[model samples]
Target: MSAAEVTAMPEGRGGRMTRAQIVNAALALGLIGFGLGAWAMDETFLVTLATKVAILAIAGAGLNLVLGFGGLVSFGHAAYFGLGGYASGILAHHALNYTAMFEWPFVFEGTTSMPVIWLTAMAVGALAALVIGALSLRTTGVYFIMITLAFGQMIFYFAISWPAYGGEDGLPIYVRNGFPGLNTLDPVQFFGLVCVVLFAMLGLISMLARSRFGLALQAARQNRQRLMAVGIRPGGVLLVAFVISGAITALAGALYADLNRFVSPSMLSWHLSGELLVFLILGGTGRLFAPLAGAGLYIALEHLLGGVSDHWQFFFGLLLLGVVLFARGGVIGFLAGGKRHG
Candidate 1:
């Protein structure tokens, strides 16, 4: 093959837009159209489902960063998710009840503000990720996965045992938190708000994946020794990625709690962690929209199949098996016409 032919490999697959890019565009438009259509028809239930998709997709994107890009298979991501949920729940609980969260250290109090909750959630998530990553990243392979799982379980049990937060019964907000200049009580308005956050985070994730730190982190994943030989510390790069990933997921969790007007220990369950992983695998790991695509499919199938059969998950499992066995690149890769490589 000539040098030019090899260099023009991408052209052979696409004209103006690559298959993946086309797929991405379609997915984005499809989601927006779905939400708008639902809003127009006053289908509040469907709109809420769409909101769930956006929120869960954000959480899955967080996992994709660590698992796909960083090659870190963390099984305890639910820890951060739950923490974010609790952050929203706890703060709103105190605010609504007119109680101070803490009287000491400058008279800290709770807030009913959504923006404030999001910031607090991210901070809590990042702090937890720092401690977890510092220890878990010290190991490799399954050991790292197990360590994360263990930490997640510890948080889960603690949440269950803590009576102040309603213990196993979970905490409820009774009302959705307030947002600036908007009636958050309205379904469409809330949906619009979540959609905005979803896209913004998606843009940020794309930038991080293309940034210098992103490349370095990818390098560390592919070849740790080579990354170090180039004078870049893989540890620092990975730690930063882990913390950022956690913060993003935590933000999603905060939104989720607000959407449901409740927070529970179930958010910290290993099952939720598994669901996040499932979303990535179903969509296609390492792609920008993998999390969104996967979560969309999962939620759609659940809603549709759920109407027909009580044991809908049994059929869902069959479809998931087919994807795992035959479509390694997941829904996006299959539709995009090729498998992606890290």
Candidate 2:
């Protein structure tokens, strides 16, 4: 194959593939290739693994808005992620059991529809983020971080004690939720569905990042006082970003539950929240394809190192340390020659 055939020639502003854009395009194509290869090999497990990376990438993308652009160090994103999972699981549970979600609320019933589940998950995630952001945004620096962490823990403990939906044991979703015209039971089909959502969200984030609001958000992060001087309310901007971030993460959570056929308090754990952050950092915070890059690398490491030793995480930590110490711009930065344009 010729070089032109292998490398994507997608045009950018100057009719050239900027380093960052090239990196993003390459990562996306890599994911598509991985998924296709898995399907071709009849490796359902690999297909499912690809789906996991896409789903987690969605969550990481959500977190990146606040952490990367808005400079918000929220440690409670797991609350929203877990909430999204519970939303889908609980709805599927009630649907399976033929139970009403509520009687007074116009006799609402549970749904197995993927679209419905996703909408509900986004709403719930946005609401939770609103509440969390409203309170957490009141502080800054370590205070904001601690407050977010505390809220996440609060949700975690609540889920553990709530016996209605399996409590500490978690809830099981027997059947995969149905998409409009897809056989969700088929791993390849399910992976495609996830890939679509992931790409759509990525496009949405890319647009937002380039839009006027995104600029303001970034400015607020760089200097809230300057933003205030320029007539923009830094708090409000940050709050909106946080809500959007939460909703996106929640959607990932919902998909993740369906992927595993299970939802549990562990999803709400602080470790998961940290993992989301790690995904963004590992891939390249603030970059468009950072989430995918981070998630793919993380999963690859987990599989390879996990097979060799249980203490893989110790070595993983060392690699992460190296990335932090040397390649501060992350995988994308390292690949793009550390120019940091995106």
TM-score of 1: 0.94
Candidate 1 per-residue lDDT, tens place, 224-271, comes to 999999999999999999999999999999999999999999999999
**Candidate 2 residue 93 C-alpha distance from true site, Å:** 0.4
RMSD of each: 3.9, 4.3
Q: Whole-model Cα lDDT per candidate?
A: 0.88, 0.89
Off by over 4 Å in 1: 1-15, 339-342
Residue pairs of candidate 1 with colliding backbone atoms: none
lDDT of 2 by residue, 81-197 (tens): 999999999999999988998999488779999999999999999999999999999999999999999999999999999999999999999999999899999999999999999
**Poorly placed runs, candidate 2 (over 4 Å):** 1-11, 340-342
